[model samples]
Target: MKLSSSAYLRAAVSLCSLLAWTAGAHAESVERAPDAPNAAAPDAAETAEVSGDIIVTAQRRDEKLQSVPIAISALTSDTLSGRGVVTLSSISQVAPSLNVKSYPASGDTLSLNMRGQGIADSGQITKDGGVGLYIDGFYIARPQGVLFDVGDPERVEVLRGPQGTLYGRNTTGGAINIITKKPSGEFGGRVSATYGSRDFVRGTASIDLPAIGNIAVRGTIAYTDKPGWVKNQGGNNRYHDFGQLAGRVAARWTPSADVTVDYAYARGRVTTTPAYFVNPSFVGSLPGYVATRDQTWTALPLPESESNFVDHQLTGQFDVSDFLTIRSLSAYRGSTSHQFVNYSVALTAPTFPVGLTGQEDYRSKQYSQEFQLIGEIGDRFSYTGGLFYARETGRHDKLQDQFLIPFNRHVISTRWVEAKSTSYAAYLQGTITPPVLDDRMKLTLGARYTSDKRSATRNSLVNGNPVEVNARNSQSFENFSPAATLAMQWTPNILTYVKVSKGYKAGGSSEAAPVFANTFNPEKITSYEAGLKSQFFDNAVTFNVTAFHNVFNDLQIDFVTDPANPAVVSTINAGKAHVNGFEVDLTIKPSSNFSVRAAYSYLDPKVKQVLAPAGTIFDRLRNPASPFSVGDDVTRYFTLPFAPTNALSVSGDWTFLQFGENELSFHANYSYEDAVYTIATAGPAVRGRDLHASEPLERVDLRLTWATQLINDRRARLSFFANNVFDNRAAQFTIAGGSPLTGYVRQAAPYSEPRVLGIEANIEF
Candidate 1:
């Protein structure tokens, strides 16, 4: 519902000038010979023996996601098990510029936004997340456990903009590459089970082993149990429940073939139960509020959450000859979390017993090492050099038990935050081609130089002494982040590109900013991109488009230092901002059992400079200190938060019916979102009372399949699924938790996720 970027630049200059005038009327329109002037190609794996685009590693090598000129998306594993994506927050329903959002009182992890960047209160363990989550080449330093459970997936590349030279630093709102599905020495197995609707149960299993001598092994296990739908207090228990168990094991050794090795072990556990801040304006203007906005509304010592993680990884490769190649990655990770939240939804217990309950405990550990050197200096250019190291340590503690209604007293606040970080990076990238227009132009340049040393500490206690909180222990940052791209292969299937990148994110320390000691710096992004990767008539149809613009400097913001005390928070540096976007990905596959896909995204956020607090000006008055007003420049009511101005996803995959080898398929998906704000609206009277936007959603997913062959030559499937199919209840998140000085402006929600229907059985051996 927001579509004018000059009609998307006149439909991308009228489809690249009508595909360059029909490829110059196809007099055998050629142009695909590039690679070898800096070299870098070959490293396939996109099934069907490759070449339908989608073979990515988003620049750390393995090209062909339309030659990787940024703006990427790849979601296979049969399109994420046909749209029922498991975890990673359902992959944003199909990656339309991604946006994940769920911080359920710090439990199930999630809160990633792409286009306009993200992170507005995302399970902060001394923050640092502008999208960057990698697994398989490890690096998940936080966001809890990144929603664990991704048992069998062999693809999930999202990389949109600013990957800062082959993923360095926090990727400035981009990077997610999951890929998990290694170990292929031969024999295999898979199993799946499901049952749904609140009492939902799920199971998954996988195993593969057959190389015996050169070694090969794989294993996976997953389990999920769901319960919960509100109700707590007088209902005994329940409040958005979920439980999970996940596991992974792997080993592979090529032993020759120029040496290759891999080792992995992963473990996971997740549990949940918090969600009910449901203040529908306090039902009847607070007098005797009675539960009513879903889940039978109740609260009190009933919310609980837990997250767990463990991973050990190692990967190595060496060829040393095809122009030299060597890569290695090592990792170790550990995590633990526990939350006992009840943040709201109290039914006047014994004279408003101030229900601000929160108990958190988190612990983390990490170690990473990476080294890469992909070579070629003779064939044109092709180069990559890397060295990265990471070290992390964390411990967070929170315990608060409310009741202070204006000091009629009862407190227990206790908090202890600790963080330690050390990082070092050195990267280099080069790509060449330019021998003339015959090489179809290519030029890539990259850089990364990062050095960070972060340290943090926060200590506070209430009834047991120790108070003073405005803290920081250490901080040091350095960044380089540079990139450039200029591609053009204009016709073996068309390709075009233009890019410029720089991204960084360092800043640390802010367990909800203890009374504004205010220390922030290190966010800086400068990106510009242009894209088009096409295919027509013969490849059936695949179109990709992108257009982006970003520029934000020190833009970390998290406000509400007491909007009537919603846990009094603060994190700033909200100065200078910009975002512009456009993206579209379409697929058509006209034959081969029918297929259709669509994805769209468009965002535009603005706010150019806004660092206030000296003399009031950017009016956003509702007075809880007028949203920190002072001397203009809250930049016209800044509104970037989760950044969501139009997002869409459409799907279709039909395979009517086949007989010779038995088959039947159908999958449908529809996703839409356009309403996002998620907090922060700084001027113009607080965006005319913007109650922390969010609540424009549409979702639907369906699946039906039946592939057959089982009985030993295994390969079977039987499914039926339905997710959110019609039970669309909005409120994807909105908060301002009432009380505009008791004038009550309402809003405090967290909804979405209701309809569920299931039946699935899968096997593959």
Candidate 2:
């Protein structure tokens, strides 16, 4: 839907007016309380002193979450453990406006979408998504290892909207910051073990050593083994089974009062069977198809997949003076993955096989460096400036074999791709509190200049003979992103802000077989946002709301050009898109023993214009059964992929009993997402049929915990948790697989995880 500029302006004004009136009325009522004289006046710290208050570094500085002008969701270690969230897939249940999906062939590959912005195909190595992922302030260069198990972290912060001004490249959608626990000066440790459904078992351990001559050390290790949720009738092996092991070591040195140094190393390995695929039974028109059965596959030729990665980081901080600080961060990372799959369900003839077998291997290495300076001037101005540099190199090797049973024909294709990139950026941001309005108004401005150079080469072989399918290509891009925010504190417990920002994602070469279609233009977004943060009822209730509108130019889109040869995918600069959304987050602590949290989001995304490629067979095809046709604009007026119109999450925790240092608590949460289209198309018409889409997702989780004192003043806790309690059988991803020439098109989909119940035990010393 298209929204006029005047309409948005009016809505923003109305929202601000309502917030102002509400804040004034609340303040007046508080002042008129009978015990107002005895109660201390609420200050910045006092107004945010509730249990819901959290410290965040969203703007590259330490501040209260209510004080940050941007929209963000922070998940602490306690919250993660309580929710049984171990990976990014489960994180979406609690984070509104975020969705994560894996490919049908491989579960390790993840596509992350936030606020209608994300890459449709995450398998493209050369192209980066609009959202950025960071671990310990260092960027993760690839999506392959994004699902690695993160041993207990201090917190995970999800920043929504454009963050390019401070975070630099590829943050048009937003950023995810994973902050691990740092070494403490005192000795501490924890151990945990879990046993769940499907014979799943997991164990984790951590240890921290006391300061030794101004140095402290900490280490953690975790391991998990689980059987597949799906049963295979064709082979003895199961699909989607996995085993993983991960470890991390960190050390901190504080030899002087003003100097500090920290170093960390992490490594992990995972081995799992590829996800199983089955023909869609719901389509009754197709011959020999049956619905109403569990996810079972009759054919399995390949079952092994592996992924591994190692990361190292070193950081240093120096207090130049009371008003200035300098920090340096350096990191290096490497990863490798191997995937094998067989995508055929049945045999078409006695002497021939109708199936496809594929094998792929990927390896990557990267190094990055960053330096920053932060200063405060006379309590009126604070500024942060940084310089960043990163270099990455990677290789991808893929082989595919297709067999036609009826004709007894076989075809083999192989592709080897190599890529390298270098990026440099400089950014600066400053916040000033004006003398007017008693320092209640603040102005923030920031900008970043980025330069990137990337090159890639692809060599293809058909039936064991080399072919010049695509030529080597090199490209360079430069971008400037700017941000400005105006914020005012209307009351001690209320703050409102308006912000405008620009974000950019660098373009890169495509691996398509066509020699002439090797490059795409950069994607950019201009965003405007307004938000309000307020607290009432003596800091027991906190509410935050934000509305945003974004305009995207030269948006990059990836899709299959030909269904017959499904191995090669094409990338194009589709056109412009307009996205507008609103989000609400609320926390209420009705009593000391009970609390509730809820989040909701509404999004409307539409393609405003598009330029189609001429002379394409798929575009010009006049078949009524085809999704595209002659004179059709493939992208115009189409809804963006992975965008859900409405999403909601509600959670409540109740502590029913507490007796002499022992406590018992119950927690439950519910999450819902509207139906979403997995692929982008014009009005869902492909081949005169409806496009593939995912069903609405609804899930509920419950947890019960008991805690008591252990020996030697230590503590011990036990918990029982259940996820997807209702066993919702929703599809995570769906697509068309079989060739259309067979007189029947086959639909394939991979379902989400089933219900799981587990028990966990933890001991702290």
Candidate 3:
């Protein structure tokens, strides 16, 4: 279900014109519902009413998803539950403009990329991600523990493109807003259990209490245990085994109709074995060797990676007057993790060759406070303004990596790193409708000013002596990001808008490469977009399309330096880059019993210039040490990390039968990702080939459910699910490497998960 960009655009324009001819003959389409992140309306019942509409908070205020003037994909509670989505990566298939993957060495860490902009090295403590992750208006500074299940949530909003005014910091790419269910004064609860292949088991429970003297509370708990499928020939350890337990408690109180307060405390822990890396064919085909590619068994033992986190949040809202409302959000969060990762293991050989391994123990804590004012000034004007502040500190001790932990170990390197940052910001946004064209056009303007201060110190000891380099200890920055949009209503069912925005990520020293830490600058982007939102055939069909172009300056890109020292990595600022893309999503609900959704994205990214310091490693054709280092412009060789040329997803839900207090339904989803290039390995090793690009991936998932009413009038359901139905396991990442002894070049490739089959049972009261 893919269409050419030009053809799609033309068809959309033609359809809008044809629909407008009869617009006056029909009443306005059903209310455009929203997906509000700040409001905890369980199941979206309190926010959206129309069958095809969604309530959303993209502008920090309740608005319809179609009316936000931004590209967004809302995953509602029903969708999440029906699809059995348990982790952050599970949403990437439905979010066309976004990409989520496990970090290089850790199985639970996350790497997010939106429209060609994201962090290449999330393992670096000081580096910030281009995309921001938020939980009920609270920002999570680190990626650890984000993959755990959170029971059932109200909705998750994925906003694509620069969101500088509302979400100020590190949003050059986009943002993800995760909103859990809020408490209702009525008593209700839910319980569920699931069992799957490979000994996978999960259980979850949640309860809500009746109101008592204007107070209400809710509690939730969940547990998951799954043994790894990849077996180890020796030792009990296995690759990808995972176990997690998480819980949360939330409360709300209201003394008067005008005042309300909410609080929540949550904690969670996840433990996992590192991913099993496969040896490339080149290295495995050598004299008297065995390749691990697509293998089910390994002689090398993999270690475990574990992370724990605690979070606290408080929010207060006040109605100052009939036209204005004030709100404040405060939060404190902390996390710690211990991981020993092996990128690639050359196993089952006559002589065991220990692969590259790294061990890290890290802890971080952050506190944030935000205040917002949302209201309309008059019949023609509306506004949203806010102020924000945050502080974060992190420490990494006993950080070192080389060959196997104990076997074939050579040079022992150890390091201790500590970093901290403080931030302040203020922002204002407003919308105005002039007395022209029958008030069908509106203009919106917004801006934010942010200031950040950072300090970092690295003390590395080789064998016993501290390293010689004295890294610069501190840095500060100030930024002003602005946004503007013009939206117009052509017909009751058609809306169009054009917008421009700016965003940036703060600069910090690379904790791994102290000498190059102060050598890079903050990365920034200016984005322009034009979009169309429309519904045809009396609200039965909906279509949304957006075309975007972004200009990037001082782009931060990471790469390994000196193959002999793979443990050391550096981040440098590439001078200029540009990304152009388009996104299209459609939904058709011909009847209440059946619905279908499809999304597609296309991207074309090019590197316009490469900075001198970054070019040496980014494109070796210009490096003095390379044999092909003299021919083409650096742009000819480099591509952004995790950005694919084309991505598409299609999903359908059908309720085919109903019999006396019983129901039956089916759900199916399919997604495809084009090949992507991320590794920045050099020229001679590349041999004029695009070895950096990984193979394309295809996924299919299906589910069937049966529901019935119990004798006591409670609702229950039973379901069976199958994921990766075809078992199309493709290598997600591949890289060239060398042993610490040098000249023994090797290759590393990691594949995706295999097929999974499971059954689940659930009940609600």
Model 1 C-alpha lDDT per residue in residues 553-581, reported as the tens digit of each score: 87876655454455666666768788998
Q: List RMSD in Å for every model shown.
A: 22.9, 12.2, 10.8
Instruction: Give the clashing residue pairs of candidate 1, or none.
Output: 37-380, 37-381, 38-380, 38-381, 38-382, 615-631, 616-631, 620-686, 637-683
Judged by lDDT against the true structure, how good is candidate 3?
0.75
- By lDDT, rank the candidates, best first: 3, 2, 1
Clashing pairs in 2: 625-687, 625-688, 626-686, 626-687, 626-688, 627-685, 627-686, 627-687
Runs off by more than 4 Å, candidate 3: 1-52, 281-289, 293-298, 344-354, 401-409, 468-470, 514-517, 614-633, 680-689, 711-713, 738-746
Q: Which ten residues in a row have the lowest lDDT in candidate 1?
A: 34-43
Give TM-scores for every candidate, taking all chains together and pairing residue i with residue i.
0.33, 0.88, 0.89
- N/CA/C clash count, model 2: 8
**Could you tell me the lDDT of residue 657 within candidate 3?**
99
> Could you give candidate 2's per-residue lDDT for residues 1-765 as a string of tens digits?
423324433443443344334433443323323233222222232233354567777776668888888899988777787777777777788897888766555666778889988887776678788788888788988877554344467778899988787773557788888878777655556767788998887767776655566787878776667777877666655677766667888888877878888899998776666666555543343344343235454535655677888999998989899989999999999999897777654212222336677888889999999999988999999999999999999998888787765667877889888889999999999999999998999999999999999988888888999886545888899999999999999998999999999998889866764653468878999999999999999978999999999999988766455645554566777778889999999999989789999999899988886655432334545223445554466554345778889999999999999998799999999999987776665233344222356778999999999988864445788999998899987765656543222222445656667898999887766
What's the best-to-worst order under TM-score?
Answer: 3, 2, 1
The lDDT for every candidate, in the order shown, is 0.72, 0.75, 0.75
